[model samples]
Each structure stands twice: as structure tokens, then as C-alpha cells.
Target: MNRRLLALVAAAAVLWPAAPAQAGPATPKAPIPVDTYLRQALDGTGLPGLSAVVTHGDEVVHAAGYGHDSTGAPVTARTPMRVASVSKSFTAMAVMTLVDAGKVALDEPVAEQLPEFRMADPRAARVTVRQLLDQTSGLADGGVGIPAAEATGSPAEYVAALRSGHLAAEPGTAWAYCNANYEIAARLVEVAGGAGFGQYVRMHVFEPLGMTGSSVGGAAADGHISLFGAWVARPELRAFGARGGAGGVVTDADDMGRWLITQTGHGPQLVRPESLAAMHAPSKVRDYAMGWGPSDVDGSRLLVHAGNLFTYTAVEAIDPATGYGYAVMTNSAGLYDDTYEVLRGLVALTRGAEPPPAGGQRQLIELVLGLVALASVGLAVLGVLRPSRRRWRLIPPVLPALVFVSYPQWVSILMNGRTVTWAQVTYFAAPLTVTLAVAALSGLVVAAAHLRSIASAR
Candidate 1:
């Protein structure tokens, strides 16, 4: 028994060196700092410009802008960029201030508060102020004019145009995302605050938060679209056009940092803590809160919002458990949007999980589309060289052309009942539109050749 014990002890001693500290499971290294991860994320991203901000409680953990604007200007944290629908959060906050001041009542009818407010629907009279911010006002984008071209270009005109439109559902009974809700809310702010929408917000919200550069209607930089993996700069269709209660609000990373600090229930008390809590609480009808949508992230509450213009895209998020806020904006939007992926990567860092690598699907999609366009041209050349004997063969190709011409009317079907303008289609749908145009033009060429040959034979 003594000899056996000695042999076992000797074997254990020999095996100890093989089982060093790393032998079992390696210790996880800390997540890279926000700034470092952000720089790394920009490495392979085929984007023109990117702006990001991360806030922790009352402090700004990181704020930066990467790449260049459309004018070839280097983007910095101070570079202004359109935050898109993220503006709703600011608009919500602005309204909240009025709510706290007893200037605007949350449950009060908006039409009662703003006498100028009128919609063709009698139900519009009952729409509450809270419904607009929560996006449960029964106002929907369906049947509304695409891009709102009919507006003479003001918030008043926007509301005036709605005079002919009706409601889709009862107030507070359902939830739907519609910009008109916020626009009317902004007009209400103008009336209640006794100042222009921009002026009231500037004095009440921006001034208190030290967000000196924020404004109501403005453009930060030129927008871009991807073409065959290459970025082509394009003008914003509504670059600071009309009243900006819906989508306007050009800002920068630094300003977003300040905004986040306030949004996470930090910074100065813009509104009472209870009012702030009210803003974050999801409504009974949906997970959408006042300005942010409440979603579950790793069993914790995440308040988030995403915005997309034809030429730009952005995302803003706040993690209540950690008091961490993140915002990411890009100058380009088309084929694919990288802003959300970037936001996810940033969110992953907060969880200590390795971030998904920065990636883009636009290049691949556009390349495949370019190849299809080339194929269409080649087929047209062959058809012209030896014209098709059957007219029915040519008829099928022309149909795609009709789809493009009448796209504004039918594109809504693909977008799930959301209206779209022909100009809007030219941006997000550029590659698809171009491909369809190529095939259609090719068909027309072949048809013309066939018709000429038949005439000569006659």
C-alpha cells in the first residue's frame, strides 16, 4: 500500500506542469475600448462617412466620426449629419418639456389644444398628445401622398394637406409608425410654446443640454448610393426641405453624446424623473415607448430607434441596465444599411461579447445586379443581330419597363403599403431600377429592329 501511494504521488507531480493556468479554459480578455472598436469597425466598411457616440450615465465614453462626407471633407465628431428619425426622440423631449411646464397635456386632445389642427376624419378630433409620441395615434402612411409633394412646404401646409385624409384606426387603439403624427405634434409645440418649432426647441431643449449646434431643418452633407460596389454621391431629395417636425434635425456625434446623456436619465433635469420614466415606458398597445421602442437585449431593457432617409441611415440605442447609450449614423443608404450592424457591434461590446465584424452586403448585391444588367445588354445585341420571329417574346421584356414607369403606384405593395415617390425609388432602388431599365431599353431596341426588318420585307 505504501509503494502504491508513492507511485500515485509521483505521477500527480509530473502531470501538474502540463495543467498550467491556461490548461482548463482561457480567461476572457476585456472588450476593446469603444474608440478602438469603432476605428476597427471602419476598416472594411465601404461607407462614405460614419458618426458614432457612446455615453455612460452622465459621461461621454466615446464620440467620433469616421471617413469623409460627400464633399471629400474628413468627418470629425463635430461634423453635422442627419440623424433621420432619431429626430423623433428630440421632438418627443421638446414636447415633454412642454408637458412638464403644463403647456401641453399628454392625454388632452391635440385638436383641442391646437385649433388649426384638422383632419378629414372626425376621429382626428379625439387624437391625444401621447398617441403621437407613442406612435399609436392610428395615423398610418398608407393612402398618404408619397414624399408629400403636395405640401407647399411648411408644417402648416403639411397639416392643411391632411385635411383631405382620414384616419386608419381609432386613437390609442392601435400602433403604427407615421411621420404625420410627429409633424402635427411639432405644430402643436409651435402653438403651445408660442414660437416657431425650431426656436422653441432651441431655447428649451438645446440650450439646456449645451447642444449649441442642433437645428430644426438642415442638411449635414451630401448623401451617397452604392453602384456596382462603388459609392456615388447624390443630393438629398428633401435636404432640409419644409417643416422638420417629422424627419429633419441635422446633428453630430458630439451633440448626440449630449443627447444620449440626457436621454439615459442623466445630465440636467429637462423634465421630471417621472416624466422621463413615462417617456421610456412602453404603451399598453405596443412595445414602442414615447420616442424609443422597448426591446429585450440579453434579458435587459433596450430603448432603441432607427432612421432611414433615401440617402442616409442611422440608429440610436440606450441600455437602461447599464445607462449606456449608443448612436451610429452613415452618409450612405442603399442596397444595404450598415448603421444597424454598427449599432449591434457597439451593443455587443457592452455585453463583453465579441462584436460581429463590420460588413456590407451592398457591394455584393450591386455587383450581382450589374452582371444581370450586362447579361441583358448582351441578349439585346443577339436579338438585334437576329431579330426574334415572335412578337410575344419581345412583349415580356417590355413589361419590366412598365413596372419602372408606374413604380410609384405599385412600389407601395412591395413596401407593405407605404407610399413611395419615383424620386425616392431612384435612391434605395437604384441598382434594381438600373437593371430593370437596362433590360427594358434592350427590349425596345430589339423590338424596333424587328419592326424595321418586317417593313422592309413587305
Candidate 2:
């Protein structure tokens, strides 16, 4: 895929919530064909591996794994995978637990709890616990210094990095999804709860929810597949120690089912109903709650969260009204939205309807773009070898080359003023991006040579 298409897909994968559709009446005991649809989706999407689980109350209606991991190991419900921003929900719950204990208040200034939490912008002093969980603290993604800090830096150092950055808007005035908000919130948990952020989560959240296999700071699953069906391993976010609250929970599908059950008001009552309700309610921004987005799926108002860490993607959703929930995880990197596709298919099956065919047009478009880039490189070389007196002939190859070289800047502009890194471009769409880069550089070389030939002839 070209960079523009890739950016659009990436944005949709991360930013957009699934649209609400009218769902059929909930059956007290409905049998969903999760396994049948998941297997077909695995084949259709070209994913290397996936794990999924559907839950109703405390019962696991369906749980299964398809395909193999990077090591050629067979996938199972027990296979661990990175859940990315799904971790945000876990962090938000941890904070709520402290609130229930009267150890922290949602509306209190975060700097009061974690004294080191300061930003270069004075408006940051007014940032509160609620704003942090709701992603309205004004510390936009691109400016957060966590991207530059030690991947294993302490929470204090993470806060210091954030302190050096400026806010994108006044606190509580606008909504911006910033990881720094969670990092600071996690730091508050460390200070108030008097334990390491990960340890605190393990004790208060994972342990209580009976999620024994879950933990924070684990590496992303190894066998992440690219859109072109090539195996690519994404580097573990070394800074997970600092940003664990934002996107770092690692767990298997079975544990995820249990977690989902709790969220849907079934399973163990680890958290009080009122507290969970608060987390699920929309914050000042109508689009996002604490860590979840309220979306309507098949007539059910489902609280959903989808996560992408470039290497692995995950989606967890619950319909409290129906006491049903599901979670899906994939070992792949790109803008394919595999998690959403699988979840939607399963949800449709539960409603006794067939989902439309999985979309593969994006992948096909990318393949065509890759071939076009190669063809441009070949034509550029040919033009250099046999210079055309008609300089206008240079426009075709030269124009695309210029566009390709300047594409990153365009992407940065589109991504809420965040700078695009070479590593990010390579991770999101490696095959097409690399080909474009090579084609652009080669085309420039040929253009230079062709211009020299014209000048020499004169």
C-alpha cells in the first residue's frame, strides 16, 4: 500500500470505533459459532496466528486458537499475546480501586498525588486523575517525552520527561489521546498504593480477577505477520516500564475472557458495580470513557477497546445489558484491523446472521502499489541510460519520486501534529514503504543523470 493508504488504515484501526447496528433480542442461552467463523477468518485474512474467547456470565461459551506462532508453535487459548491499549482499561480500573479506598480522588490534581507530574505548560497543574484516564489532559501523543526516555525508566523519570513537554490545550478543555496521561496516572498508583505499578496491578486487578497468567512489561508476541504474509517481530516497548499503564498488558485469551466477564457484570465481583459504571460512562468527551469507547454493536451498547502496538493488535468488548463479552488477539503488525473483523463476525454469528466477506481489497491495493513502485524504479533507470531530449518525459518518474520523499511530512500533518519516525513507517507498512523509498532515491539519481546529459548536449 502507498503511505497515504497505510496512514488512513492505521488511523481507522486505532481511532475509529465500530459503528452501532441494531442487534436482535438477547437469548438467555444462545450458542454462538465463534470457532467456525474464526477459523474461516484466519484463512481469509492471512494472519499467522490468533486466539479468541467469548464469555457469558462466568461461562466460557467458546475459546480457541488458530494457526501457528513465529516459532512454528501451535496457538492455543493459553498462548500469551500483547493486548496493547487494552491495558488502558486495566490501568483505569486500578485507579478506581484506589478511589474506592479513599486513597485517591478522581477530580484532584494529579500533581498533588505525584508531585513530580508537571509539564512545561502551566495549564498542566490543573490536570486531574479523571482527565488522565479520559485522555483530555492536553498532553498530546507527539509531544510526550516518554518516546525518548529509557524504555525501562522509572515512573519518576517518565513523569520528568512529560514535565519537559508542553500541553496541546488547556487541561479539560479538549480531548487528545496521550499516553503520557496514563504514565502519570500509573505513577500516582505507585505513589499512593505504595507498590510498583506492575506489582500493584498484579495484586489488585489481575489477581482479584483470577487472571493468573497476565502481567505487565512482557514482550510483544514474537510471530507478528505483515500484510504481505511475511513474519516480522516487533520490538518490545522497552519503555513499557514507564508507559505500562497506557499499553503494556500481556495475557492469553482464556484470562481475557475472565477479564471480560467481570467488565460485563458477571464473573467475580472484584470491583464494585458503581465504580465499574463510572469507568464505563462517557467522560467530558462523548467519544471515550476511562479507557473504553462506547459503541453500539447489533443493538447492544457495548463498551469496547481496541489496541495496536505495531506488532500485535487486540480488541475486548462487553455488552453489559446482555451479560456477554468477547476478546480477540492477533500476532501481526499493520492496519488490517484483524481484531475488529474477527469480533464483528463472532458478534454477527451470535445474532444468527452471517457477516459479509472479510475485506481483502486493502491488501490487494498495497500489492499493486508495490509493483508500481518497482516499475517506476525500472523506468527511471532506463531514462537515465537513454536520455530523452523531451525533458517533459521526466515528469512521470520525477513527480512520484518527489511525492514519495515528502510523504512522511504529509503523514505527520495528518496525525495531529505528531512527527513520523522512520521506524514507525517501516513497522506499519514495511514492504510498500521500503519499495517507495528505494524507488524515490533511484528516481532522483536517474533524474540527476538525465539532466546532466541534457546540459552536456547543449
Candidate 3:
């Protein structure tokens, strides 16, 4: 999954009050049945498992989970699930701590600080730490060694491979959401903080907010995708090599509540308000800050970010206007993202508006594809047993088969040139992939039978 797609959350025209009411006794909003809404989402969306946390200031208003994972374990707020690219915000917090300690200069050229971040592009020499955090370094996914799969082995090897990476634009000239930005930022924290990236995050980010013993990596739940109205579990095709900041952080709703509290300017301050402000502040080049993006929900503003992996996806949002924070994580994903839909409903709940009902889109689409596949198989079987006179029609059916052959290329084009591997298409687009395969294979079988019949007639 291209994690960049996770941004903008709902394209949300989410409403927020202009300011906190003052000078009168506040009428407390009645408690909303967050559980009822979440349960509805789980059943309607056909998500195998869902977990979420809602926070108002430092208080956890709600934290719970629904359904069960592939292992038959009922998902709960405490279950470690993959938050995917949401981990970037945590990584940004870790680096900001180093910045406070005067160890990492935000504007210093990355090559000067670490010396390992060399690139064939001379413009890479000007890439700054702040630019890396804000995703304006112009380093793109096309850069050498940027893909998590390509950078295997230890953290040192990952950084070493970036020596020949190419930049998409000059530093600070534009904003592009490249995972490599966070990967390099994580490596910098390791070198500057004198600890591994995971340990550094644990020490500075999680542990400070009273979340002790929590680290980056864990045994994340098996992710699932919808196929013919059933959930099919799929293993992640690639391990985030060295597990940098970009993706592959296993956290739960319980931990997420505490993290959100810190984000919304409550609980213990991990970084000073000024430092946190930097994380939330939008870059001049784009609305994206370090790991967060600014969005206007009507007249009010909210800081939002999203996470997407093949099997699992997540989204996080903070309403600075209301000091309300939300985190939604799911253990499954597909071409359509139900995870963000749930988050949108949660935001509506915060506004005292009923969360509008949503679900069934994925199931409906998959069912139609399944029927088409069945019809293709049935037609081909009939054609083989009782041959066709016009064999020319068989050739056109074979063309759909080429899509299965060039599956990755087709998906990459759809994703705006982002790389989509063969194994990945099976998870997010399984039903569509199955339908195409059935149609193509049936074409070949029918063609062969008709060709034999033509030879006999001759």
C-alpha cells in the first residue's frame, strides 16, 4: 500500500466549535455509545478485527476492540496491532528529543551530521534534518535503497545503501510523502542518541508518558483482506528492513490513548510545547509538518495522519480546537480503506453528531467480481465439452490473461508510479485478481478446445 494515500483522513469537512466555551457552566455532552458504533463498523465493513481509542484532554473517554484476529484472539485495546505509517509521528517525537538536547541541529545538512547519507545527486548534500522530518528533502521513493524491502540487514546497512540515492527535487523546494524521509530520520536518532531506533523511541517517546516497557516492534496480528465477502488473512510480503520509522510499529488502542494525550497537549510533556508545536506546525512548502498534516475541518483545524500496509491500516487525528484526540487501527486492508471511514464516524461522535452509518461497499464489489469469475469458468467448461464454430472470439478473452501476467505494472500505474509487488496485489485486490485470473485461464482453455475442433473439421 502507498502510505501517502492515508493522508487527508476523510477529506473531512469535519466540524469543530470556534473556541472552548467560557464564562458559563458548561453543559456536558451526553455520553455517546462509542462501542455500538464501532461494533456496527466491524460487522458492516466485514473487518476481521478493529481497535480504537478516544481521548479528551488527558482522560481516556474510550478504549476498546471488537471481533477477533486470525488466531481467534479477540482484539482488545491492549492487543499489539500494526499501526503502519502512523509510526512516523512517534519517530518524529524521538528525534525532537535529540533536537532539545542540542545533539541534532534541525537545519544542519544531514550529510554533515551523519556523513553516511551520501547520494549521487549533488543536491542531496543540501538535505537538512528538518526537511527530512517535514518530507521536503525531495528524496523520493524512486531513490535507491528507499524501499523497505531493498534495505536489508542492520540499520547501518540501510543508511549505507542511500549513498547513491537520487533526489526528486531540491531540498525544501517541495513536499513529497516518501517513507525514506522517516527511515533516515530514525537512523539519525540511533547515531545521535547512542541507541537503536526502537530503543530510542521507547526511552524518549513512549516511556515519558507513563507507558513503560513499550517498544516499536512486536508480534503484530495477521492482516486480512475481503474476498467474495469473506476475510482472507495474508502475511506481509516484506519485513520493514531494520524496522525504521516509516512503517511496522505494533501498538494498540490502550497505548495509543496515552500517546494521543501527549499529542493534544495533555499529560506529561514529552517534548516542550514549543517542540511539539514544531511537529504540528505545517511546512511552508506543504501543509505537512514533521509527521502530521494540517487540515481544516470546516472553520476549525485538525492535525491528521494515516497509516497503510497491505494487510493492516491505521489513522490518527488531533483536534487542537477541542483538545480531543482519536486513533483508529484495523487488522485488515483492501483496495478500499474501511479504517478511515471508522475514524470519520468517531470524529462526528466527538462533535455530538450521530456518526453516519457506513459499510458493505467492499463486499458488494467483491461479490460482483466473484459472479463474473464463476460465469467465466462455466462458459469455458461448456466451450471445451461442446466446441465453438467461430474460434476467433477466443482470442479476445485471452487478453484479460495478460493483466494477470503484468499485474504489478497495472497496479503501479494506478498508484501513480508507486511500486506494487505481485504478492501485494493478492492481499488488497484478491477478488479482482481472482476474477481476472479465472477469465484469462478460461480463455486459454476454450481457445485450445476450439482450435482442436477446427483441425478436425478440416
RMSD of each candidate relative to the true structure:
13.0, 4.9, 6.3
Models sorted by lDDT, best on top: 3, 1, 2
What does candidate 1's lDDT look like per residue over 1-458, in tens digits? Answer: 00011121232233222323645765677788878877777765778789899899999988988889988999889987776787888889889999999999999999889888887889999999999999888887774443552344766777776777778899999887778888888888888899988898889988898988788776467788877677889877762232366678788889889999988889887999999999989888998887788766445478988777767778888998899999998888765667766887888887887776676445556666788889989988987898756656667657767766776666555444566667766876787778878988887887877776666776
lDDT of 3 at 115: 89
Residue-level lDDT of model 2, residues 81-112, one tens digit each, is: 88878899999999999999989989999888
Best by TM-score: 2
The TM-score of candidate 2 is 0.89
lDDT of 3 by residue, 196-276 (tens): 988888778787786652467666757787788878887765656215677747788998999999999999888779999
Better of 1 and 2 by TM-score: 2
Error of 1 at 28 (Å): 6.2
Candidate 2 stretches greater than 4 Å from native: 1-6, 10-32, 150-152, 219-221, 237-243, 298-300, 390-407
lDDT of 2 at 77: 90
In model 1, the runs with Cα more than 4 Å from the true position are 1-30, 144-150, 239-243, 296-301, 449-458
- In model 2, which range of ten residues has the least summed lDDT? 1-10
